[model samples]
Target: MAKLRPNLTDVDPVWNRIRKEAQDAMRNEPLIAGLVHSSLLHHATLERAMGYRISMKLASAEMSEQLLREICDEAFDSEPMLGQAVRADLAAIFERDPACHRLLQPVLYFKGFQAIESYRVGHWLWQQGRKDLAYFFQMRISEAFGVDIHPAAKIGRGIMIDHAHSIVIGETAVVGDNVSMLHSVTLGGTGKDDDDRHPKIADGVLIGAGAKVLGNIRVGHCSRVAAGSVVLSDVPPCKTVAGVPAKIVGEAGCDQPSLSMDQLLRATGE
Candidate 1:
């Protein structure tokens, strides 16, 4: 069973609580002291620690850890929004995931959070016109985390991906704020038409496991896409959709479907 740590109301409190958790972890298990020290205790701030952690995880034969760390540091330092997004992401996981006891879990153990942070650095690189470096980050993240999010994909803050295995977000995909999804979700395109392809998932949307949303369709805000559904068209705001070539089954049944994390498909009595 997972032991819950100290409560955190916001990003600042989260960092403080994570430090406390790290201290406890070191005292309890000395074997991982060095790991905890390097990953969590060494840095002065969450962004700095994240820079070190992601670089260490994604470093390859082509790119050394020191170089990767420098790049990540530069990204974190230059792009303030990256850190903001990261904080939001952490908060999203802590609040939404039942298994997550502390903010440290997402920083250290969650591949979804780590992958998204790495993708943020990649997106920064892309914005700076360093396409090759961005692509490199994309490759490393996919290889290490099994979550293939294109560097060009525009993802907003406070996103949570549960059991985030085999998740794919295409280049033209746009995921909005406070959105949540489970494993094996694909925001992909229908064909080779490269321009403006892939799905646009709006704020507070909840996408279920193994759901495939194809093409340049809009999934409106606060919507719910059921598990194993194949969505090829636009979904209206606050609606629940299901089945292959998914249809509107019912209302979202709540204001924020993502926050609720409810995948229940109440029969519409159609």
Candidate 2:
């Protein structure tokens, strides 16, 4: 458990600096504020990872490392795609959101940034066989942040948890790139098998507020899940779904946010 914690090497002062920088950056970015809230909950995810790791000691260290490598990559910032997606998200936010300004504000204040980043570190430690410590940090981050992500979940790049309050992503959930989810969205199970029970969100899908997607269903690319809807079955690409058990409601082609000149000019500050 102790092994899972950050090494805290005297030679490396970067972690503290990075944390401070992230905080300072998010102090003002409106888009990042939601992410910051989510990040505060990262500790829970880490704890989950640690618990999982404790069960992996029967295997050899090399085998344990191999089994957890993919999860670690998916969790930590060591994977370049994560950073790229984050940057792209910031760019898109800047292009469309008038209330945001300065990269620093978002980096520091966004719960998403902090939680995701903490997951990365916790994931690394979990992989190294220090499950208890990893879980400790993960739960701490989760308690601090409103966001809750399972360490075992496979999340892709360009994943956007927009306005992510009350959002719960479960274990065994697979989220693809360019997927956007609004507030109060839940990717959950249906009391089925513990393995691979959550839904899979494909690329370029937009999920509206308060939507619940359950079971092992797949939400296809370019699909739109309307607000307050509950998805149960698999949705095809380019479709829009709504209702209790979400059904195809309309076509979802190029449905994106747009920013006007006045809106863009309203909040451009340092």
Candidate 3:
């Protein structure tokens, strides 16, 4: 029941023709259904659709299906853990946010997911010597999503950014695995020096609300940056940092192994 926006609905006749024809042709196809049935693949297609609509709205025809396909393949391969984490986080966010209607409304309407996913594509495009094209696409996503993430920043897997309003990631910023950040988190620069001049967040780091992490600091693994902390320097592993220019305040989150399906199978010897 999800719709392609009203403004773009004018083209629905053409798109519907093509989509139905394709679906009809693939109705009995085995492999085609395999791809289409995957929840992850569907999520990706939806994101590409979002990117396309945003591009058209901005009057930029630069977003091609070929380019989007390249972005989707590359991004999907590059960040499996990140993608899983992001999806899981978004599901939880949807469950909690009373504003979301439990349907796919948030996915279609929420700019946060759309912008971030497109930025992943933008980053791929940038690395492939398409800087100008990448920038144009980024602008389109920004205009649509109200969220900005520079393509040059490095991010790891399973990054869940919920209600990600005003989130900014600097060019040199590096985020490690399983990092979750709430609204208004900034990984930014301090001065004019371009030499590794941004923050490096290690694995399993949870950045709280309105936290600003600046400079070339390293926030260690399994750490939590408390709400409203303006971090300026390095934080030790297994610790919590808080307050202005954030300093260590409490113990880190407990480290426990998350048992995988294979692990459970081995435990049961089935």
Q: Whose lDDT is greatest here?
A: 1
Clashes of 2: 34
Please identify model 1 stretches exceeding 4 Å from their true place: 1-11
Residues 77-185 of candidate 1: C-alpha lDDT, one tens digit per residue: 7877887899899999999999998789989889999999999999999999999999999999999999999999999999998988999999999999999999999
Candidate-wise lDDT, in order? 0.92, 0.58, 0.62
Query: After aligning candidate 1 to the native by TM-score, how far in Å is the CA of 181 from where it should be?
Result: 0.7
The numbered model that scores best in TM-score is: 1
Give residue 54's error in model 2 in angstroms.
24
C-alpha RMSD of candidate 1: 5.8
Per-model TM-score on C-alpha atoms: 0.94, 0.62, 0.64
Of candidate 2, the 10-residue stretch with the lowest lDDT total is 259-268
* lDDT ranking of the models: 1, 3, 2
Worst 10 residues of 3 by lDDT: 257-266
lDDT of 2 by residue, 1-270 (tens): 122434333332333333444456467566665544443222233233222332232124333544543454344434444334445554544444445564434444455544554554565566667787566545654665666766666666545555557777787788886666767889999885787899998877778889999999999877788889999999988677888988886666454312121101111121
Best-first order by TM-score: 1, 3, 2
**What lDDT score goes with residue 111 in model 1?**
96
Give me the runs in candidate 2 sitting further than 4 Å from their true place.
1-82, 95-98, 124-130, 255-270
